[model samples]
Target: MPLKQPIGQKRLTNVAIVKYKKKGNWFETACYKNKVVDWRNGTETDLDEVLQTTAVFKNVSKGVLAKEKDLVDAFGTNDERAICTEILTRGDLQVSEKERKLEYENLFKGVATVLSEKCVDPNTNRPYTITMIERALKDVHFNVDPKKSAKVQAFGEALPLLQERFSIQRANMRLRLKLAAACKDEIQSRLAEHKVIVESKEADGATVAIVCQADPGLYQVLLALVRDLGKGHGHLEVVSLAVQREGMSGEGQASGDIQGILKEQQRASELSQVPYVTSQPASTTGRLRARSEEDSMAEVSYPRGPISGIPDDVTRKPMFLEIDGLQPGWEVELTKRGESGVVDAVFFSPSGEKVGAFVQARRAALSASKKAAAAQSTVE
Candidate 1:
């Protein structure tokens, strides 16, 4: 219902006049009842312009008035304002904004799992503020206006707000591709297991169904990955890798793309002799064995990816590693630089089992050719 009653001659002294300077223009936005209304862009001036501009909507409960009052009461004094301004100038606000963004990202990590687990209404599917929808949608052509960007930001600030249509669109795309791939793989594996020749052709450029003897177990695995996405990092393990064929006979047709890629993958997997995956443990056994062989004789160990040492208060970028039974004066090499240097000292921790190897820059090793050249130059 429209608020028809007029606030006649009622002087609102405590009314907040929020004047934000953005892109060189001052925007006077009046907030009440947690709603933002009556916005105008003009010169930054006293409180009169904001009050006059918003007087028409004064009858409507501006929800933000309560929040504004709370904020003012919390830190309204000149001293508190000075502290806030100083902190903002020193980039504390930027850091705080970054922390908030990080929190959003961390929360969004479980979204795929949540979506996969249950059948949700397409209409109910909305992009929560936890997901960076604007960043995801920046490349989308329609919502490129500056006003739209601000609106998106505002929506993001009030988190758990749903962008239903947008979420459904992306979710449907992800789900379709994922389910299709799983279906195809399951069908092919079952066919091969039953000694049936699984041949996929893209001759007509139509959607191809993977044919196999029906197995109820494969379907369960698919449901587990899709529905239990949040549990056991299920979403991460469920791979939906795109299989693309480049410079194929088709010019503009997407007809052969899916069929060709699937056939190729099927052929490759058959050749490699992929065992029937009854469980995660059986599937990982081979890979784990290979990794164990690789790391067996080595005293130092690093994870498969980058080994950036833990972040410290001083923000030092040096790499640090603690290995068990690391002997003193042994060379330690970080793989990136491919340099092995003699350890400066091997400090034993209080536990006595772990040893920390510290190496200086100068004792680094070089390739045989480099060493040979240096020796020849010294002789000369």
Candidate 2:
């Protein structure tokens, strides 16, 4: 499991080693106790005494020392110290499975802690506990790469999966800002990085008005700016807020998630509302049985690949949807929450002789889209 621990020798404890390949020959170096030190920077005592061994080896785990001739040929020196320095500084460090597992676990929790502190429930505007974030991650079977930083991966890589199931959002505090005209330039400079919308030019000549979505910490800075610069002329109004996904419509508004999508005769229609659904989630365990061997579920666009992009790890609850035209035992199921909002519709047949399925979009989202377009046109 751990790169075949070279045969019968037990490697030394507290002595870290680097495995290097030079001119098709493998060499390993022994560094100071439990650390892979830079050979260029260590003091003379660290090289002479603390380093467990000066003899470079072909395999530390096997007790096989590198030959002098091979070392000279590969490194242009028979000197073990010089060769060891190059190998130690330039080579890859090998880690045991136990060590690797520990590092992996630490990094996984680090990512979770980062998310717990920086993100908030979009509904409640409160941070999720670390336990809750960790559970959601386990449900998604998230993999953490030891090479990447926990903070670096938290938003771009980890959060997307959690968002599909949880209500987590990177915290953004929506604040309504009003200040004396004299403080305008400084306030703008301070909040330039945040999502600041110039709400309106106020009727009073001496006042400036704006709406800014800022980090919770940034509120203190706003308070200070207004107190120090505006001379008690203005105040801050706080509103419920959460960070919106990039490229979504409006300043902080989210275009509604696709509740369901139906394709009838090669046409794709977006469904906004599920008029009727049972309290439980659908049981999507095995393959859906189709009407005929000649006609497969793949023929239709409703369910996406691998039984419709629904990963097996998601916590699924069974839900029942009713279709009017289906025969006595036949049924159509509409599932929600995974990948693209919904897993689309999977219709089952009772008799398998004459199987037909048709789905229609709920009109609320369609009507809203049209109304928004009309309002924008009128404004223009």
Whole-model lDDT per candidate: 0.29, 0.54
CA lDDT of 357 in candidate 1? 27
**Cα TM-score of candidate 2:** 0.41
| Model 2 agreement with the true structure over 118-137: per-residue lDDT tens digits | 77543223355466566668
Model 2 error, position 244 (Å) = 17
| Deviation from native of the Cα of residue 226 in model 1, angstroms | 33
- lDDT score of residue 50 within candidate 2: 35
Task: Give stretches of model 1 more than 4 Å off.
Answer: 1-103, 109-288, 297-348, 355-380
| Candidate 2 residue spans exceeding 4 A from truth | 1-11, 31-55, 62-64, 67-69, 76-90, 172-194, 197-380
Model 2 residue pairs with clashes: 280-318, 280-319, 281-317, 281-318, 281-319, 282-318, 282-319
lDDT of 1 by residue, 1-380 (tens): 99899666645443433443322322232322111222222232333332333322212224222233333444453243332232222211112355446545433433322322211112212122212333323223222222232333333421123232122222221112122333444534544564432233222232323322112224445445444432332221212111111111111222333233233323323322454221111222343343234234334332222223322421112323322122222223221111111112223332333223232212221233357678889999
